[model samples]
Target: MALDIIAALVYGIITIIGGIIGYINASSNISLVSASICGLLLIFAAFARLQGQTWGLTLAAIVTAVLLVVFAFRLAKTRKFMPAGLMTILGMLTLAVMIHQFMALRR
Candidate 1:
């Protein structure tokens, strides 16, 4: 459970860093702004989970699943071991850990 919480925080921080980089590279793009907002939400969700909020984990699960699909598509199209591939792999591992923790809670 502690590991899951830490992973969730790492996930959120990585996403925010990516968004900041993207925004710096493309200042005029609306998408970067949207991405940054989503990243901020992820950070909030992580904090919420840290405070024992059940909805936080649920929200993180949904966000990570979406990110996994996006990264998977990018990896498939490029067919290389790039950032997309790396993130996709991490997202899968994190998602698995999250699911296992949730299952334990149910029992």
Candidate 2:
């Protein structure tokens, strides 16, 4: 549980930072808006996890799953491991942490 909360918080922070960078580098409002939404969702998910809400974990898991798929696809298509690969790795770790916490809760 502790690990899950910590990982979620870290992931949220990283996501927010990435969003800000994306916003700065984005060529259009659409990308900026999308990044903003993603960052906000991640922030809320982190707070929810900290509050011990099941929904928070669920939200984080869902978001991470989506990110994992996207990043994995990008990595495969580009054959690069810098950002996409790295983010995918982190997403996977976060997912694992969430699963561990959920299983412990079930027991």
Candidate 3:
């Protein structure tokens, strides 16, 4: 659980940084806004998990799943490994940890 929470926070920070970088490089307001919201939500989820709330990890898992798919699509389209591919891989690991933690919490 602690590990998951930490992973969630790290992932969130990475996402937020990615968004800022994306905006800086491409000037995409959409990317900045969306990523900021998503990253904040993940950070909030980590806090909730720290409070022993199962929904927190569940939220993290859902968000990670969504982002994983989106990044996967971006990777497929761009064939790039720096942002999209990297994020996709990170999201997979984060989601897996979140799911495992949630299941253990439920049991």
Best by TM-score: 3
lDDT per residue for candidate 1 within 1-107, as digits (tens), equals 47677777788778767666756776736546655665666667778888899788888888888888987997999887655788799889889978987897799
Per-residue lDDT tens digits for candidate 3, residues 7-92, read 89999999999999999999999889989999999999999989988788888888889999999999999999989999999999
Q: Kindly report which residue stretches of model 1 are placed more than 4 angstroms away from their true locations once superposed.
A: 24-31
Q: What's the distance in Å from true for residue 23, model 2?
A: 3.9
Superior by TM-score: candidate 2 or candidate 3: 3
Per-candidate total of colliding backbone pairs: 0, 0, 0
The whole-model C-alpha lDDT of candidate 3 against the native structure comes to 0.92
- Itemize residue pairs with steric clashes in candidate 2: none
lDDT of 2 by residue, 40-65 (tens): 67668878877878788788788778
lDDT of each: 0.77, 0.77, 0.92
Name the better of 1 and 3 by lDDT. Answer: 3
